[model samples]
Target: MAIRFESRTVDGVPLLLAFPDSNGAPWPTVFWFHGFGVDSEVHRPELRRIAEAGFLAVGVDAAGHGRRRLPDLQERIDQPHEQALRTMTRLAAQTAAEIPGLVRALADEGIADPDRVALVGVSMGGYLVYRALLEPVALRAAVSILGSPEWPEGDSPHQHLDAFCRTALLSITGERDENVPPDGARALHRRLDEQNPRSVHRYVEIPGAPHLMDGDQWAVVMDEMPRWLERYVLRPAHTTPSE
Candidate 1:
């Protein structure tokens, strides 16, 4: 399984892309987001796994992170709780705004099939996934692990449930997560259920899991992500509206 890795700046966003070394233009793509204070390189293994599963997995470094990280990024993150939360939310919003541009760039380069694109993230990255989904960009599926839909600022995901009616979203959270509690996801799921959109949107909580999940819990996450994508994004009949 030969997977080629490339680091490039597309649409002004630093990205680490992994895909099959062999020819197959316009592959199904997953634009993954890394947690706060971390960079895309941390997800190298996950990116490789996604590539082996027949995808052009692109790891995105959210603003104030990775190559774009500001010199005082660590200090800002280490600030008091309320101050840090605000900073993180701002970065999430900025990063989410950049996604549409990156999607257009990827499609133009013929590296990602515009129709088979998905978003996956963890923690603050997961928050980014939800923020991006609120946009007009048409995504086939999304997986948010240990993420939240609430922004605590402008335009939270709860305010735009209708936008997600066409895209399938699977949210995974730890039952014992206090840093970013599962309540946000639980509330969103209940709302989505009420909307009753044809698209699949579900939330899963790992028993006895914490904000920073252990190896066994991660196993469940790794297993569930591929299964969800295979069923919703890789299936031939699965189609999403063009952006």
Candidate 2:
């Protein structure tokens, strides 16, 4: 097991990285994204929990938050006033540009498997996961928490969802979530459903859960995530649209 804190310039953007310290050899890697407002601390336990389950965990604090110390356009867009679509678009572009470089660096560090990587993101991070889905890079799986695919008032993406994207996806939502209404989940699911066109995807709506149920329902997620990872992302081969 090995753990390290490192930094690298990805597409000219300075990015931060945190990896697990463990005994597993050539473990699977998790490319993690943090939720809005909160720092990396909010995601630490979740990463540790996943790492303890025998996977490499690499997390980034979305440029502005935590140690990265850059302007967080997402949070800035969420200010008291309404934000323009262009602002969100720029942030999303920055995110997409930096992610691949981050993944490459992790692979070079022996902290991630370029072929067996999975993504788990929360809230705003969840939205970014969908954005990543449209990426041409190889991704084994994605787990998005309370993120919506529907436009956030004035949000858009880098490109249209490719009909070729059959990447395994698991979008989880809390039934009682005030932050993400039921309609949003349904819409996102519907969009992905359309994007895949011929493939069947998985969407889970947990009952009696709230916006941040990490504390209350952590136990259920701990039990369920492994199977989700095993069935779709961690199998012998990465599932493709053609699979």
lDDT (10s digit) by residue, model 2, range 70-188? 46645675765335333433444456556787677667866577877777777767767777776666777777777766555443441355522456677788888876555565665
Clashes of each: 0, 4
List residue ranges in candidate 2 displaced over 4 A: 1-25, 70-78, 84-93, 153-164, 191-200, 238-242
Best by TM-score: 1
lDDT of 1 by residue, 1-243 (tens): 999899999988999999866587788889999898999999999899888888899999899898899999999989997788789888988998887888889999988887788999999988888888887677888999998887677777778887766778999999999888999888989887876646578789999999998999999999999887776777563445322
- Candidate models: Cα lDDT each: 0.86, 0.63
What's the TM-score of each model vs. the native? 0.95, 0.77
- Model 1 residue 24 distance off true place after TM-score fit, in angstroms: 2.0
TM-score of 1: 0.95
Superposition error at 243 for model 2 (Å): 3.7
Write down the worst ten-residue block by lDDT for model 1: 234-243
Rate residue 20 of model 1 by lDDT: 62
